[model samples]
Target: MTVALMWEARAADGRGAELLAWVRRQDLAPAPLRRETFRAPQDRVLVITWWDAPYDAALPELPDPPAESVTRAVHRWRFEAVTDH
Candidate 1:
């Protein structure tokens, strides 16, 4: 089964774009099968990566963003794909 990891962070005031750029530049390991990024109000950025492995598999994950660029702790969630179209 495939698995997806969702990571989110709220950038410090007026730093959303910078945070997203930094994230794009950082090297996340275990190259994902697919990846997507989203941004929202309040400087929130979310990144979801799909991996070719089970949910319980040990997958490489993105490291925490620089403290100065984040307003709150990073949030992460994992999901296993039940079906794919």
Candidate 2:
């Protein structure tokens, strides 16, 4: 089944860009990563990524745990393909 993995993180001042750039360079084998940005009312930066891959193969890589003070949180979501008229 195809799944969509989503990740969100907030960085310190002048760190969001660097963090995003680092993520772009990461080699997420097996499946590719698609990133998007969202604006919060408080101006906090929010980044979301969608990855298409199998549940078993991608779960481990999706929520990559917290990286000390660099990443606040990593979220993941899995969705099954829907086909209907």
Candidate 3:
């Protein structure tokens, strides 16, 4: 099975660039099959990682940034691929 993990966060005030840099510096042990990063108008940063594993399997994910770097807690989600269609 294939699993995708989504991680999103909003940077504090005008610290979007700093937050993005911090996210890019993170390293995932046993890296995923694929990974991507994105940013939005509201200083929001998003990261998605694809892995070859069971839906319920424990997977590596980006951790939250330092308290002063973000406006709130990070958001995360996990989904299994639906390729039957």
Mark the regions of model 2 whose C-alpha exceeds 4 Å error after superposition.
Answer: 33-71
Cα displacement (angstroms), candidate 2, residue 33, comes to 8.6
Clash pairs, model 1 backbone: none
lDDT of 2 by residue, 2-77 (tens): 5555555565455665655555555555544565655443223444545556665634343342364254555445
Clash count list over all predictions = 0, 0, 0
Q: How accurate is candidate 2 locally (lDDT)?
A: 0.51
Model 2 lDDT at residue 56 = 59
TM-score between candidate 1 and the true structure: 0.92
* Full candidate order by TM-score, most accurate first: 3, 1, 2
lDDT of each: 0.90, 0.51, 0.95
- Model 3 lDDT tens row, 1-85: 9999999999999999999999999999999999999999989999999999999998878988999999999999999999775
Query: Which ten-residue region of model 1 has the weakest summed lDDT?
Result: 22-31
What lDDT is reached at residue 6 by model 2? Answer: 53
What's the lDDT for candidate 3? 0.95
Assess every candidate by TM-score: 0.92, 0.54, 0.97
User: Which parts of model 3 are misplaced by more than 4 Å?
Assistant: none
Report the lDDT tens digits of candidate 1 across residue range 1-85.
8899999999999999999998888666768999898999999999999998867999888889999999989999999878657
Scanning candidate 3 in windows of ten residues, the lowest lDDT window is 76-85
